[model samples]
Target chain A: MKGLVIVIGRDLRLALRQSADAWLAVLFFVLTATLFPFGVGPEAATLRQIAPGVIWVVALLAVLLSLERLFLADFEDGSLEQLLLSPLPLEVAVLGKVAAHWLTTGLPLIAAAPLLALLFHMEPAGLLTLLLAMLLGTPVLSLIGAVGAALTLGARRGGVLIPLLVLPLYIPPLIFGVGATESALSGLSARPDLLLLGALLLVMLLVAPLAAAAALRQALE
Target chain B: MHRFANPARFTRIADRVLPFVAVATAAALGVGFYMALFVAPPDYQQGESVRIMYVHVPSAWMAMFIYVAIAVASAVALIWRHPLADLAAKASSPIGAGFAFLTLVTGSLWGRPMWGTWWEWDGRLTSMLILFFLYLGHMALMHAFDDQQRGYRAAAILALVGVINIPIIKFSVDWWATLHQPASVFRLDGPTIHPSMLWPLLITAVGFKLYYVTVVLLRIKSELIAARLRALDLARLKAS
Candidate 1:
C-alpha cells in the first residue's frame, strides 16, 4: 500500500514538473474536436449530432497519444528495472502508474470535454452525462492503453503499433460512452449505458494491470 | 502434450499426416462444392446467392476456430514453455486472418444480392470486422519486437487478452442486432438450413478445417526450418 502510494506520488510529481505533456494532450483534444466541425461542415445540428462521438473519440486519441511515453521514460532511464526490483509488486506499480497517468492525461481530457461539447452546441441536459460517461470511460482507456504501452515497450514502430493494438479494444467503451450521452440527449435514461461503461472499467482495472505487468517483465528481460 | 514438443518429432508427424489431410481436403471440397453448386436446391428466398453461404459460413467458423487455436497454443507456450507452441501460434495467425478476410468478402458478395447493399453495420458483420482487426493486431505484435523471444511472449499475452473478443463476436448478434437497428444498417435473420443444404455446409466446413490443418502443418514446418537456417547462419558468422 505504501509503495503504491509512493509510486503514484512520484509519477504525479514528475507530471506536475513537466505539465506541458498533459496540457498538450488537452490541446490536441480541443484541436481535434474543432476540426470535426470543419470536416463535416459548420452546421450546428450536424456538430451537435456528432458531439458525443467526437468528444469520446478525440479524448480516446489524446489518451493514446500520452500512453506511448508511460513506460518508455522509465524503461530508458533504468527506473523501470529498479521498480521491478522494488518490494512493490509490479502489478501494483502498474496500477499506480496507470492511476497517475489517468490523473494527468485522462482527467484533463474529461475536464476539457464539456467545453468541446458546448462548442458543438450539445444540449445542457446531455453535457453532464457526457462528463459522467467520460469520467467512467477515460480510466478504461488509460488502463487498456497501459497494456499496449507495456506490450510495445521496446517495440519498433511503437507509436503506430499502439493505436492498431489498442483501438479495437477501445470499441466497447466508445460505444457505451457515446451511447450514454446520446441517450441523455434523446431524453432517455443513461443509466444502462453508464452501468455498462462502469462494468468495462471494472473489468479493465482487474485485467490491465496484470497484463501490463507481465508485458513489462518480458520487455525488461 | 510435451511428447510433441520436439520440433523434429512434430514435423515428422506433420509430414506423415500432410499427404492424407491434403487428399481428404481436396476430396471433401470437391464433393462439397459439387453438392452445393449442382445438387442442392436453390433457396426460394435467395436463389443462387445462397451458394455463397457454403463458403462464408465455413470461413467465419474457421476464423473463430483459428483464433481459439492460437489462444490455446499461446497458453501452452506461455505456461509450459513448450518450444513449438509459439511457432504454431505464429504460423496459425495468418491462416486465421485469411479466413477472416475470406469471410468478409464472401459476406459482402452475399449481401450485395440479398440486402441490395454491399455492406451493412449489422451486429454480426461489425463484430466480425473487429475480430479481423484483432487477428491483424496479433500478427503485427508478433513481429514488433527486436528480440524474437520477447515478441513471442508479448504476442502470447496479447492472444490471451484478446480471447475475450471471441465470445463477444459469437454473441454480438444475439445481444445487439435486435436491441437497435440503425436506420442505415439492415438486419436479416439467417434462414433455417434444410438437411439438403446442411449436408454441403457441414462437408464444406469440414473441408475448410482439413485445409487449415494441412496448411498450418506446412507453415509450422517451414518456420522450424527457417529458424534452423538462421541459427546455422549465426553459428557460421560467429565461427568466422
Candidate 2:
C-alpha cells in the first residue's frame, strides 16, 4: 500500500515539475472543442444537442494523447526495471501509475469539460451530469490507455498504434458518459448511465493493471 | 496438448488432416450453398433476400468463434509457454478478420434490400463493428514490434483483454433496443429456425470452420518453415 502511494506520489511530483504535458492535453481539449462550432455552424440549438458527444469524444482523445509517456520515460531510463525488481507488486505499481495519469490528465479534462459545455450553449440542467460523468468515465480511459501504452512501449510506430488499439475499448465509456449527460439534458434520469460508468470503472480497475503489468514484463524482458 | 506442442509432430498431423479438411470444406460448402439457394423454402416475409442469411449468420458465428479460439490460444501461449499456440493465434487473426469483413459485407447487402439502408447503429451491428476493429487491432499489434516474439506476447495480452467484447457482442441485441432481430438458432429451449433453413446454416457454418482450419494450418506451416529459413540464414552468416 505504501509502495503504491510512493509510486503515485513520485509520478505526481514528476508531472507537477514538468507540467506542460498536462497543459498540452487540456489545451487540445479546449481548442478541439472550440472547433466544433466553426465546423458545425454556431447555431445554439445545434451545439447544445451535440455538446455531450463532442466533449466526451475530445476528452477521450486528449486522454489518449497523454498516454504515450505513461511508461515510456521509465522504460527508457531503466527505472521500470528497478520497479519490477522492487518488492511492490507490479500490478499495484501499474495501478499507481494509472491513478497518477488520471490525476494529471483526466482531472484536467473533467475540470475543463463544463467550460466547453457552456461554450457549446449546453443547458444548465445537463452541466452537473456532464461533470459527474466525466469524473467517473475519464479514469476508465486512463486505465485502458495504460494497457495500450504498456503494450506498445517498445513497438514501432507506437503513437499511431495506440489509438487503433485503444479506441474501440473507449466506446463503452463514451456511450455511457454521453448517455448520462444527454439524459440529464432531456430531463430523464441519469442514474443508470452513471451506475454503468461506475461499473465500467470498477471492472477496468481490476483488469487494466494486470494486463499492463504483463505487457510491461514482456517488454522489459 | 503438450505432445502436440512439437511443431514437427503438429505439422505431420496437420499435413495428414489438411487434405481431409479441404475436401470436406469444398463438399460441405458445395452442398450447403446448393441447399441454401435452391432447396430451402424462402422466408415468408423476407423472400429471396433472406438467402443472404445462410452466409451472413454463419460468417458472424465464425467471426466470434475464431476470436474465442484466438483468446484460448493466447491464454495457452501466455500460461504454458506454448510456441504452437502463439503461431496458432497469429495464424488465425487474419482469417477471423476475413470472416468479420464477410459478415459486414453480406450483412450490408442484405440490409440494403431489406432495412432500406446499408447500415444502422443498432446494438448487434454496432458491437459486430467493434469486433471487426478489435480484429484489426490484434492483427496490427501482432506486427508492431521489431522483435517478433515480443509482438506475440503483447498481442496475447491484447487478445485476453479483448475477450470481454465477445460476451457483449453475443448479448448486445438482447441488452439494447436495436433494428437487428433477436437470436433465433441458439436458445435455452431449442432453435426457432425451421430445420430446412437450420440444416443449411449449420452445414455452411461447419464448412466455414473447416475452411478456417485448412488456412490456419497452411499459415502455421509456412511460418514454421520461414523460421527455419531464418535460422539457416543466421547459421550460414555465422559460419562465414
Candidate 3:
C-alpha cells in the first residue's frame, strides 16, 4: 500500500514538472469540441442537441492522444524495468501509474468539459450531468488507456497503435456518458446511465491493472 | 491437447483434419447456400430482401463465435504457455475480422431496403460495428511487435479485454430501443425463428463454423512452418 502511494506520488510529481502534457490534452479537447460547431453549423439548437456526444467523443480522443506517453518515458529510462523488480506487485504499480494518468489528463478534461459544454450551449442541468458522467467515465478511460499504453510499449508506431487499441474499448462508456447527459437534458433521470458508467469504472478498475501488468511483463521480456 | 502442442505432431494431425474439414465445409456451404436461396420461404413482409439474413445472421454469429474462440485460445496460451494456442489466436483474427466485416456490409445492405438509410444508430448495428473495429485492433496489435512472443502475449491480453463486447453485442437490442430486432434464436424459451427459415440459418451457421475451422488449421500449419524456417535460417547464420 505504501509502495502504491510512493509510485503514485513519483508519477504525479513527474507529471507536475511537465505540466504541458496535461495542458495539451485539455487544449486538444477544447479544440476538438470547438470544431464540431463549425463542422455541423453554428446553430445553438444544433450544438445543444449534439453537445453530449460531441464533447464526450472529443474528450475520449483527447484522452487517447495522451495515452501514448503514459509509459513510454518510464520504459525508455529503464525505470519501468526497475519498478517491475520492486517488491510491490506490478498490478499495484500499474494502478498507481493509471491514477497519476487520470489526475494529469482525465482530471483536466473533466475540469475543461463544462466550459466546452457552455460553448456548445448545454443547459445547466445537462452540464452537471456531463460533469458527473465525465467524473465517472474519464478514470475508466485512463485505466483502459494504461493497458493500451503498456501493451504498445516498444511496439512500432505505438502512437498510432494506441488509439486503434483503446477506442473500441471506450464505446460503452461513451454511450453511457452521453446517454446520461442527454437524459438529463430531456428531463429524465440520469441514474441508470450514471450507474452503468460507475459499473464500467469498477470493472475497468479491477481488470485493467492486471491486464496491463501482464502486458508490461511481456514487453519487458 | 498437450500432446498436440508439439509442432510436428500438430502439423500431422492438422494435415489429416484439413482435407476432411475443407471437403465438409465446401459441401455444407454448397447445400446451405442452396437451402438459403431456394428452400427457405421469404418473409411475408420483407419479401425477397429477407434473403440477406441467410448471410448476415451467420456472419454475425461467426463474428461473436470467433472472438470467443480467440479469447479462449488466448487464455490457454497465457495460462499454459501452449505453443500452438497463441498461433491459433493470432491466425484466427483475420478470419474473424472478415466475418465481422461481412456482418456490417450485409447488415447495411439489408438496412438500406428495410430502414431507408445506409446506416442507423441502431444499438445492434453500432455494437457490431464496434466489434469489427475490435477485430481490426487485435489484428494490428498482433503484428505490431517485432518480437512474435511479445506480440502474442500483448494481443492475447487484448483479446480477453475485448471478450466483454460479445455479450453486449448479443444483447444490445434488448437493452436499447433500437431498429435492430432482438434475439430470435438462442433464447431461453427457444428459438422464435420459424422452422422453414431456421433450417437454412442453422445449415449456413454450421458451414461457416466449419469454414473457420478449416482456415484456422491451414493458418496454424503455415505459421508453424514459418517459425521453423526462421529457426533454420538463424541456425545456418550461426554456423557460418
Q: Each model's DockQ?
A: 0.64, 0.63, 0.63
- Model 2 earns a TM-score of 0.95
Question: Which digits, one per residue and each the tens of the lDDT, describe model 2 over residues B59-134?
Answer: 9889989999999999999999999999999999999999999989987898787777898555666677888999
CA lDDT of each candidate?
Answer: 0.90, 0.90, 0.88
Q: Can you list the residue pairs that collide in candidate 2? A: none
Which sections of candidate 3 miss by over 4 Å? Answer: B168-190
Model 2 chain B is weakest, by summed lDDT over 10 consecutive residues, at: B179-188
Q: Give TM-score values for chain A, per-prediction.
A: 0.99, 0.99, 0.98
Clashes of each: 0, 0, 0
**Residue range B1-240, candidate 3, lDDT tens digits:** 899899999999899899999999999999999999999998887888888999998998899889999999999999999989999999899999999999899988988988787886666677788888899999999999888888899999999988965564345333544322453321212566799998888899999999999999999999999999999999999999
Q: Sort by TM-score, best first: what order?
A: 1, 2, 3
The predicted structure with the larger TM-score, 1 or 3, is: 1
Over A1-221, each residue of candidate 3 has an lDDT whose tens digit, in order, gives: 99989999999999999899899999999988888888999999999888888999999999999999899999999999999999999999999999999999999999998898889888998888889999999999999999999999999999999999898888778778888888899999999889988988898899899899999998998
Q: Over the stretch B56-147, how does candidate 1's per-residue lDDT look in tens digits?
A: 98999999899999999999999999978999999999999999999999989999987788897777777788889999999999999788
The regions of model 2 sitting more than 4 angstroms off are: B168-190
What is the C-alpha local distance difference test score of candidate 2? 0.90
Residue B189 in candidate 2 has what lDDT?
A: 27
